[model samples]
Target: MLNTPVTIIQPSDGWRSLDLRELWDRRELLYFFAWRDLKVRYKQTLFGVLWAVAGPLASMVVFTFVFDKMAGLPSDGLPGPIFYLSGLVIWRYFANALSAASNSLVGNQTILTKVYFPRLIIPLSSCITGFADFFVALGVMLVLMAYYGILPGIAMLLLPFLLLLTMASALGAGLFFASLNVKYRDVGYILPFLLQLWMFCTIIVPYSEVAQRGGAWRFVYGLNPMGGVVEAFRWCLLRGAMTGPGNANATWILLGTGVPVALFILAAGLLYFKRLEKMFADIV
Candidate 1:
């Protein structure tokens, strides 16, 4: 009789020992997970994908009425609708991505116990699923821009970089919170309130407002990561129309501060997630 070979698997040790090759090998599973999330999100919903456009659209209307009409807030010299929608679209994507990714491990607890795959895939897929909503909302923004006769300028070329920054920020924060959620469970409850506060702190109103305050205020706001992304989105998409407090100098300040902070969060989150990876199946 021929001898049979047995394969053994063991947990990795040390910070630098993470096997990213495994994640690359499991790319197919990642796609399936992302597709499953996209379908489950719209399943049985009456409006289907329209639900993606609705949230940002509704917020734009309220912001237009309350901030532009009532509070008399500035629109950065762009049309009120497009101005608010610009910020709303980016902010909504990050907020939704962060929320979904943070709960991914706990939400899919059964699968974690039954199988072995890159645990990072759960939160990463949730973030990727948010791109569906982002593109839908972006389409609505383009329509509004056309209606307003606002043309995108050469600055629009920076969109891909800005978008990468946004996704990185969401993934970083989500991984951190998702890991915590497995043990504390209260992370799920506190996340909504925290996101609400984060939105207000960011340039949901206008970068001009934050920039005008200047000094430590702008520096602190840039540390939020999303603040820079929102500003860059406006700089890219609304460059031809924006006339308020925005300027090239402000954009530089925002990017310089936000990019570094976002990179830090992403690195830290990955390290923390790897450290906790071995215990997720048991705790989750």
Candidate 2:
């Protein structure tokens, strides 16, 4: 009997596995990428890492002028610079992370076409770089606190959770945008504008109390994940609770909702990313 020739076959589909574990297999790449990002970020700048610290410090001065002096917005008894800088630190980290992470895939198209590592690591590493700025902001905040003689209470313990939420939200949004960007390059163009609008929504300069006062929007605005984070940061670092009664149910509830929503968005983004990833070599 004549042997039948074997025919290799494959599926024609728009999706594949995310292969997140592949990150471990390429941990070296992640470290190198992260190092490269940190180096390039500070190398040419004369100010070095001071550039990171300067952003929040400069913004604090601006908010002190615009909101505190011009608009007469209350700082809720916290020093104006400290109040504004708290919000600025969290917002800056999230904004930087979301912006850089969203472009990680498309920005490195040559790598996408050549060898392979977990694509998520590209964005994840980029996001990690933003924390350097966050730490700088934290140091500045502490110095301002000392200058102002403000005492941060036990509420400050909540700071880490708020930071975690900010990161989760940024990562989720980044993944969704990155996936969309790979298919439609225009999304990449619009991302900066989108993040700017998002920055306002997070109450970066003005307090969330102002954002909530537009009526019925209190709860709806809480849907903005950064809303909870900014509010929580203030509560924790200001040595007080949300209300005079020392209760913080609002902060907790908002964080509860925002964290899960962020996670869901991340999961959905992964699915979407996998679905479109196969075409990157061709289209990108």
Candidate 3:
């Protein structure tokens, strides 16, 4: 009998660079993953895709009444509905995407155990699933804009950049939490409360109020990744007509402070996720 040669394979160290080429090579798999998530989201729902915009629409109404009417919070110069909806559109997407990504690993545990693929694809697909909702909810913003007589301006070109920032922020935080969640299921419980607090600190309130606090508070406000994203979205879609807190300089300041923090988070998340990724299969 002839002896057959054996080939040995080993898992790479956790600290290595991500294989982007491999991810690209498996692009079709990513598409299927994203499609699976999207279908699962609206599957068996009464309203189907309409459910996507419902939450943000309802939140806009409640916020307009409570913040704009009851508390008398200013919306810069823009109308309350437009201002709130503008921020809500972006906020809702980030919140939903972040939650989806955070839970992705545990949610897809069966696939993780059965197959070999880039673990990042799971969370990345979760992020993609939110785009459907994002675009759907965006229509609500347009309707509000028409009602309020707001039009897209030159700044509208910046929307793609703002969107990219939102994606990065969501994925960064999501990866960090998703990795932790595999070991500590408590992350799922804590996420809702954290998101609520995060929203209040984000675009739920007018930026003017945060700016008024001055000193370190202003700097701190800029540190919140979504703060800049919300403001930038408002600025772009509102035609730069927002006054006071919406001034060009202030928007730049928030972006200046917030962008770096977002990028830093992305870097940190990638490092951490890669470090622990090898263990996920065994652990999960």
Candidate 4:
């Protein structure tokens, strides 16, 4: 009897051919990775989980103090803290996730060289870790909502879609930056400056009503992706305010344009990452 040898196809030494379904098949591993990341983030910190809750909460407090009080910004006449925190939750998730994903490939160099899993999954798992923190923040939001004596509208039922939108936006950008950072270490250096600019771009510190009244700002504000997200949050939560108009058609327009832009950027980023992934282990 003769022994036969089996042949197999291996992933190219490149990142271009990222297979979503194949990654999905590795769903068990993905869950494990996500859970592991969550554990790592909170493992030895002094505040532990409060560190997660405090980030957005602290930012919200500062914004409410300065933007709403000193700057005299309006929150569509809703409680400034409530309004700003809602927007902050979405913006913080996206910014934090994008930053983490951008650095993931470099940080996990050991795993990349030793094992073979989808390279894209590394950054993707980073972003999902933020999603785990999102619910923790949501619990704080419930307390804030009660403190403000505001009732959420039927639109509150749409929270899932909004959450999905934030996830997609982060992951789309996450994939882009992750791939880019592998080739250019400069991507990491520039990320903070970029997010700082992104911070002012979104009405995170102050709500959109303050933005709309600044005359020229209203139009320029439309350029930010989170504009629509913030508006929807207000509509869902702040409809009872004296000047509150809830959401606007403009937000719908941003949502419409943003979804495609995010997908386009993600696809292009994936392709670029795949092209450069071949060189990561060697140069990194």
- Model 3 has an lDDT value of 0.87
lDDT head-to-head 3 vs 4, winner = 3
lDDT of 2 by residue, 184-277 (tens): 8898779889877887667543344544466457667657778777877777787542333223665676667677777776777777767776
> Quick one: how many clashes does candidate 4 have?
2
Q: What is the RMSD of candidate 1?
A: 2.4
Alpha carbon lDDT of residue 110, candidate 4? Answer: 92
User: TM-scores, in order shown?
Assistant: 0.94, 0.87, 0.94, 0.87
RMSD of 2: 4.7
| Residue-by-residue lDDT tens digits, candidate 4, 170-215 | 7767777877777789998899999888877676433345445775
* Minimal lDDT window, size 10, model 1: 10-19
Clashes of 2: 0
Candidate 3: residue pairs that collide: none
TM-score of 2: 0.87
Candidate 2 residue pairs in clash (backbone atoms < 3 Å): none
Q: Which runs in model 3 stand beyond 4 Å of their true positions?
A: 1-8, 11-14
- Model 2, position 34, has a per-residue lDDT of 79
Tens digits of per-residue lDDT for model 3, 65-135: 99988988888888888888888899989999899999999999999999988899999999988899999
Write down the worst ten-residue block by lDDT for model 3.
Answer: 1-10
Model 1 alpha-carbon drift over 4 Å, by segment: 1-16
Evaluate residue 281 in candidate 3 and report its C-alpha lDDT on the 0 to 100 scale.
Answer: 88
Candidate 4 segments whose C-alpha is farther than 4 A from its true place:
1-15, 204-220, 242-246
What does candidate 4 score on TM?
A: 0.87
